[model samples]
Target: MPESRRRKAAVQKKRAQENVEIEKNRELKGSPRWWAPLMVGLMLLGLIIVVTAYVTGGNYPIGFDNGNYNLFLGFGVMLVGFLMTMGWK
Candidate 1:
């Protein structure tokens, strides 16, 4: 018939936690206008690097005499772009 003190406290605590989470989320305001473009650019640049390396035979653009290293370098650039996606909104 009536609410218990313990139950009310628990509900209040839960609500407080939920409110905090909501406020924190609101404060973020999301990513910047240029974020998506930059992220996509990095990813495409990485892909282009690998493709260029292949087309140029790893001797023109990224001169490394060693083809394998060029591949690694290209992949590394791609990885950076992929990693940036994690922070994307």
Candidate 2:
């Protein structure tokens, strides 16, 4: 191969690698639109559970009381997070 051709190929390869890295960084850098809310909701739910448990002295079956509701909420949040993470091109 010619010297110029080899140099061009190397530059192209480097550019491709840089593009891929940028894309990956864009993918991983943020919590995404829905992710932030989902994470915040989950965290708040955890906080509520902890506070309630401490206040009630573990007398109430908090987890059992709203088990399905919380599960559904989590599923919905997870679905949103998944969709957001996918990041449509």
Candidate 3:
């Protein structure tokens, strides 16, 4: 092939490869609408539960009869939030 034709072909091939890479990256990117707010809400709710439990001496109805239940529940909620963050962009 002529030198000019070879160069043109190489340029086109490079551009095609770049476009494919860009599309792959776009596909891998996370959803901005769902995970972020959900994660934040989980964390906040966890914190609130923890504080309320602490202030009420674990007597709250949510804890049922055990004072430690709220503590564990709060930590579990917070852990879920942390896990959710991994999916956020």
Best by lDDT: 3
TM-score of each: 0.71, 0.42, 0.68
Candidate lDDT (C-alpha), each: 0.84, 0.61, 0.87
- Model 3 residue runs over 4 Å out of place are 1-23
Predicted candidate 1 versus true structure: per-residue lDDT over 37-66, tens digit per residue = 888888888888888888888874568878
Kindly indicate the candidate among 1 and 3 with the higher lDDT.
Answer: 3
For candidate 2, write residues 1-89 as lDDT tens digits. Answer: 45788888999999999999999988777544676566556556655655555566554334555445544554555565456545433
Q: Positional deviation of 85 in candidate 3, in angstroms?
A: 1.1
Assess candidate 1 and give its TM-score to the true structure.
Answer: 0.71
Worst 10 residues of 1 by lDDT: 59-68
Q: Candidate 2 regions off by >4 Å? A: 1-31, 61-89
**TM-score between candidate 3 and the true structure:** 0.68
Model 3 error, position 24 (Å)? 3.7
